[model samples]
Target chain A: MSVNILLFKITLLFYSVATVLYLVDVVRRKEKAGKTGKAARWILVGGFALHCATLLARYLEAGYTPVANLHESLSFFAWTLVGIFLLFDIRYRMTVLGAFSCPLAVILMLIGSTAPTAMKELNPALDSWWFPVHVTLAFLGNAVFTVAFVAGVMYLLQERMLKSKKFSALYYRLPSLDVLDSINYKCLSFGFPLMTMGIISGAVWANSAWGGYWRWDPKETWALITWFLYAALLHGRLTVGWRGRRAAIFAIIGFLCLLFTFLGVNLLLSDLHSFKAMEGP
Target chain B: MMNIIVVGLSHKTAPVEIRERVAFAPTDMGRPLHEMRALPAVAEGIIVSTCNRVELYAGTHAPEACVGQLKAFLAAYHGIPAEQLEEHLYDYQGEEAIRHVFRVSSSLDSMVIGEPQILGQIKTAYGYAAEHKTVGSVLNRFLHKAFSVAKRVRTETDIASNAVSVSFAAVELARKIFGSLDGKKVMLIGAGEMCELAARHFLNNGAASVMVTNRTLERAVKLAEEFQGQAVPFEEFPQRLHQVDIVLTSTGAPNFILGQEKMEEVIRQRKNKPMFLIDIAVPRDIDPKVNKIDNIYLYDVDDLQGVVQANLKERQKEAKKAEVIIDQEIGQFSRWLENRDVVPTIVALRKKFEEIRQGELRKTFSNLKDLGPKERQAIEALTAAIVNKMLHPPTSVLKQNQETASGSDYVDAVRTLFDLEIAQEEDDSELS
Candidate 1:
């Protein structure tokens, strides 16, 4: 295996270790378990460094930004998600958030590693300056929404535990509903714009490459649909005072649409921007 | 042997009249604690004087005399007749006493099993005892151990993790849904007493404000004044439903006061903010279908009762687990007590060796011709010297361990090797 693949595998190992430690912290809430949370954080940081190294190595070898295939897209998405989560961990000091997010990173990395990773030549027709910008913006937005999805799920769990009046260890471990709803809002505020910019930039790039900005490709159509879903969720939340459980569930629904746009579209549906395109945007 | 003796009356063992008369004021604990320590054979004392129980924990070398004096002193100090209080009083000594304290501190012995307040109450009692300087090393170590045992039961088992009352269940449910009740508004729809009490529970839990609406405007104003909240006209409450996060309705309405259609309009008007509706009225003020709406939670009194019942069942299970933990702790604590009891353990070991030496000598004297009294004395001296020499090293080590409170393993090993419990039983039988 090449250095990039080796680096990616090590990153997965680090994330798996972090995932286990985070799960321990989630379940066990003793003073001793606090040290476990701390250790998980440092391990996650190590994994993130290795992940960065893997991406840098991939970019060095592939002669372009490395997010051009399903495997690379998933890996990059996981990388950005971990990065965003670490930043939030710093601000929130929420180890339970890590419990929710670390397992997700490990799962994403595992799925990304299963795809065949042999390097291929960049396509001549699709190579452009806009490719890296569009993919970067879009993937970053998706990563932010991924966190919102995690927060949304946590909110629902907390809501049900409170609503049903049946509390578990997780209920005590999770942050308050206000904190989770605000996190959802914060993610939406950042992610929606990044997503909008990515779509617009994709249109601009489409105009440059295909001589039209308005082709109804499957990826484009689903991205638009996903955008509308998030748009409505955000609009309802801000203008209509949609809060707490409603916002949490809406954020979760929006994430499913976003996930279909990113994953289901490229694999199941034939589109202008499939892995078959060779130089993915 | 050092004994922990408890003399007390609890909600289970005594009527409230007896308990209230005997209950020691926490502020004036120093006087009673001082008097308890001054009692003969009572080495140290703690007075745990909660509403449900008033227990006197005494560290004594003479459990019988100390327990008797404590019982008598309780009646004298409270000016109640000894005969009147005697039937209500119960006592436990040694292992049973420590186990009782552990169970009480962990809330396994509570009136409401697994209620959390008892632990804090015990801690406060312990603090008062410490402040009064009445608790010596044994009671001090024992009380701290009880506290840690309570903490162990708290973390290891979910004993005190749920609400057992309807009002508390409502507060807990609201907390889960809204996270913190801070800045959340509550609306009281009617003047029913249960509804008002539930509203107070919400207010106390940090719900930002309360809005009262009754069919009678004057009564609404009166109830609103008590809550320090604005009185909403009954007709206007539905229009203002958007203003509050929690709505508690318990009016004597014959039919449903709130149905799905009205709630849908209110939900829309509120812009999909989550709302909690607690219907405490017997006739059911809110339609059950309102629960089907998005972001709206509806619970009647039955649901609240169900939550309380389930929580109580869970607590019963947790209480069983707590008893197991306390049993384990008592075993460890017994070893700790044995280790700290250096002088007594030393005396017991010496007695065991002496008894063996005398038994062998008796057998020797029976088999042989009478060695003169001189020879008999010399043989006795030899055995005595040997026993002292053998015990000196381990005995001195055990003595040195007195300050550090270590050597429980050594103490336990010695007890097991010597079969000390058999010696204890014989000693107890002789004393009786």
Candidate 2:
């Protein structure tokens, strides 16, 4: 196997181990199990380092950004998700969140690994500097939205437990509603702006490369729809005080729309931005 | 086997009159703690006195004798008759004693389940005992374990997460809405007793300032002065509503005072910042329809009471989980205590065997004046082998039984059969 493949495997192994440890700590719910959470966080950091190495090695071998294929883009997406989650873990000190998020990262990596790992040449249309800027901002926004999605799910679960007056193990392991809500708000505030910039940058790149700023491509249309959904969530939260259950439900919906825009438009629908290099000629 | 004992009266077992009488003053704790440690059987002692309970936790070699002495000490300390105190006092020993301390420290046994004060009270009690030099190694380890167990229960269970009183529930709701009250403003309308109490709860929780408004200008000024707040005329309060984040109203008005239309205008003027309105009046000063308005939340007396009741029920459920945690910790501590007995028994048994071996060797050596040095060493080795061969079975049995319920019984049987006299002072050093 190549060095990049070896690094990818090592990253996957560490992420899997961290996920198991986090799950065990969440299940045991004992004070002694706290060490497991700390260990899991350190292991995740190691995995993130290896994941960065894998990306760097791939970039060197491909002679262009490696995100021209589905596998590379998914791997990059998972890396960004883990990066954002680590920032939250440090700020909030909620280790149980790892139990919720690390598995999602692992799943994304697993899906990414299943795709073809062969390097592909970038399309001539994608060789502009705007390519990297637009893709990075888009993935970073998705990563923030992913954290918000997890927090939203946790908020709904915690709210159900509190409202039903059932103090289950999950209830104790999850943070309070206030904490979860604040985290959701923080993610939205950060993600929404980045998303706006990504769309604007995409428009500029399209204008430069395609001779027009507007496109009726499937991907472009879905991206607009996803942007509008998040814009409405942010606007309602600021002006109409949409929060708690309403905010949580909207965040989950917005994430689904984002997922469809990112994956569904690329795989199922014909689009101008499909990165045809992934189609194996 | 019951080395730890807890003797006390709490709100559950005694009335406030009796609890107050038995409670030890902090300034006077030194004499009582000293007297408790001075008791013959008590190796270590701590006296925990609070408004809700007065408990004496002691570590001792003789559980029964120590309990008797503590009972008498309590009678003598307060000059209360032994019979009267006996009716109110309760005692727990052995595993029961350890579990009681764990539960008490975790606030499972508080008058209001999950109240946070009892843990601090116990910590203060332990502090006094340490300062008086009454707590030895055994109690030092046990109390620290209790503290960690309490912390685990707090983090691993939602026992103390919710507010169980009306005033506290209001504060909790405010926190839920605003996340933090550091710079939040509070306004009090008409100054009913319950409203003032809830306002004080908000202030204690970190509200920046309070504003008071009543029908009578002098009364509003007086109430505001007491709270170190600003006084506004009752009629002008609505015009200034945008300045406050929380509004508590409890007036004698027969109808809704703060209606939906007025609140909608205020919400618009405030730029839709979230507002919490607690209508504590019987007729409800704030209109119920206002609850549908965006950025406005209103809870009346019944609503707060409903929250309190639900929170109380949640605490009761969490208490069961806390008890399970205590049981697990007690099992661990009890194993340690049992292992403590095994060491001394094994030491004493080994000492007895060695003594016999040495005595026989001395006799052989005296009779063999003409014997060679090699010959003397051979006889010494043979005698040592005999002792070891005889001790191997029983020593293995004792070691294997250390964690079982019958471990202490086996330890006592061995001590009695061998006529072992293990010095108590020697074991004290072993613990350290």
Candidate 3:
């Protein structure tokens, strides 16, 4: 295999190991072994680094942006997930968010490895700087929602554990529900603007490339759905005073839509964007 | 079999006066525990002492002997006669006793349902019993299982969520107003329990500073120290109220403490800043008319009650989901227990029939010494089938009967009838 494929394979291994370690930490209720969650974070960071290197190498080899295909988008999505998680940790000092985000990153990376190697050649209409900017911002924005989803899930789990009065092994290790809820809100706050920018840029790119700004393509439609859901969540929180579990649930559902857009639409359903289809090793 | 019984009064069945009469102080538990254990029918005993209720759980061969002894012990402990104690005490025996332990551990029996304090109290009782050597395998297993079941209930149910007390509700209400308390200022008026609780909540939420003022300076200082806040003099209340974003006033004062004029002046000085004033005192500390101010949100005891009621309603709604989860968890645990009950019999039956087949095979091999290897193998297969056919019915009967109450009797009967007693003893030895 080539250097890009080799690095991609190694990143997959790193993610699988990280998932195993985190799962063990959750199941065993070991706060000490949760320190291994830090090791998993580092492995993810390494994976993210290799992932970036592979993307860069593929971009250089193909003489265009590597994210023009479904497999490439998945790889980029995984890379951006770690990027967003690192940003969250720096801003909120919330390293515990890794337990959720890392597995998601691994899933995206595993999906990325299946992209057919011969399909790196971009279609004639895809050759522009706006393509990279629009897709990059979109990837980063979705990554933020991914983090929000993780926080939302943790919030629900922690809330349930607390409400039931079962201070079990998982409960003590989890961040407080309030903290998770706040982080969920924060991720959406950071994400919504990036997503707006991505959507606007995608519209501009599409107008220049395809003669119309909105084709309601599967990717575009799903992106709009994701944007609308988050937009409603933000509006509800600010206007309706929707706080805590409701907000978390909305965030989680929005991310699910985002996941479907990234993985499901491109893989399960063939579309005009089928050139982005990923193939397994 | 001798049964362990638990009988007593709780906050529900009896008034505080009667509960107090039977209540065992933690320091006083050891003496009654010894007295109960020494009774003719009592073999072992444990005393669970709490502020709301006191219970004596005793294991004894004579269940009726435990009743009179418990009544006598309560009478002696409280300096009352047995007849006076009899009116207050309720009794539970056998399965009811086990159910009571489960209920108590799960906090369903707590004065506040889902309060976390009961589990710790139950564990403490277990520890005390272990220390006094009053617990044996049966009671030990029973209580341990109760603890596990309690844990399961908590994990699988939403019984613990949003069941906020007055103090916590005050805090939660304050949080909804202030998005984040990271740098908010709070003024706690008086050193009452409500004030202390509100102060702790603010401090926990990252309040920048808390100024506690009371009619007495010493009490204020002590309450402030507990929460790592500052204690200001009562005279500074009006001046400090302007500076703080949130004011929690809970005092023993018999009348309205804050006049309309004073609060209006403070609000004017604060330049229309949003302020949350919680009046938790009985006679109402903050002037109710101050609620007229644009940004002044005044909540008296009634308002707090409303909030508490709403939170309880929300909890009740979520509780349905939690109940379903708890029921699922219980089902899972029951399945595991059911599987555990049948495991030994299954192993015993399988081992017994396998042994019979091996014995028949050896006898066949001795009888067929002249047979070739291929012919001998075919004979062995037929011999094994014959042994299996003969044992299948009885062995399956044993397996099927394993979950019933009479399962052990069946095992014993099989051991006697087939001389499987030697095999059982050998298995027992292997287990040991």
Question: Among these predicted structures, which one has the highest DockQ?
Answer: 1
For candidate 1 chain A, the 10 contiguous residues with the lowest summed lDDT are A26-35
Kindly list the per-residue Cα lDDT of model 2 for residues B29-117, writing each as its tens digit.
Answer: 88999999999878789999999999999987678888899999998899899999999888999999999999999999998999999
CA lDDT scores, all candidates in order: 0.86, 0.85, 0.72
DockQ of the candidate models in sequence: 0.32, 0.27, 0.05
Evaluated on the second chain alone, the candidates' TM-scores are 0.78, 0.79, 0.65
Predicted candidate 3 versus true structure: per-residue lDDT over B333-394, tens digit per residue: 33323323334545656677788778877887888788899997887788778777877787
The CAPRI-style docking tier of model 1 reads: acceptable
> Which digits, one per residue and each the tens of the lDDT, describe model 3 over residues A146-264?
88888888877765643333345565466655567678778888899999999999889878877898988898889898889999999887775566667878988998898788768
Q: By lDDT, highest first, what's the ranking?
A: 1, 2, 3
Model 2 clash pairs are none
Which parts of model 3 have CA positions greater than 4 angstroms off? A1-281, B76-79, B173-184, B189-193, B204-208, B213-245, B250-300, B311-432
Candidate 3, RMSD to the unseen true structure: 12.6
Note the residue pairs that clash in candidate 3: A69-A276, A70-A276, A114-A279, A115-A279, A163-B160, A163-B161
How many angstroms is residue B261 displaced in model 1 relative to the true structure, after the best TM-score fit? 2.3
* Winner of 2 and 3 under lDDT: 2
Candidate 1 ranges with C-alpha deviation above 4 Å: A23-39, A90-101, A151-181, A209-214, A238-254, A279-281, B25-35, B75-87, B114-116, B123-134, B155-157, B342-432
The 10 consecutive residues of candidate 1 chain B with the worst lDDT sum are B423-432
Query: Residue by residue across A15-130, what tens digits does model 1's lDDT show?
Result: 99999999988886222348789999999999999999999999999998888887898899999999999988888888889999989889889999998787777776667888
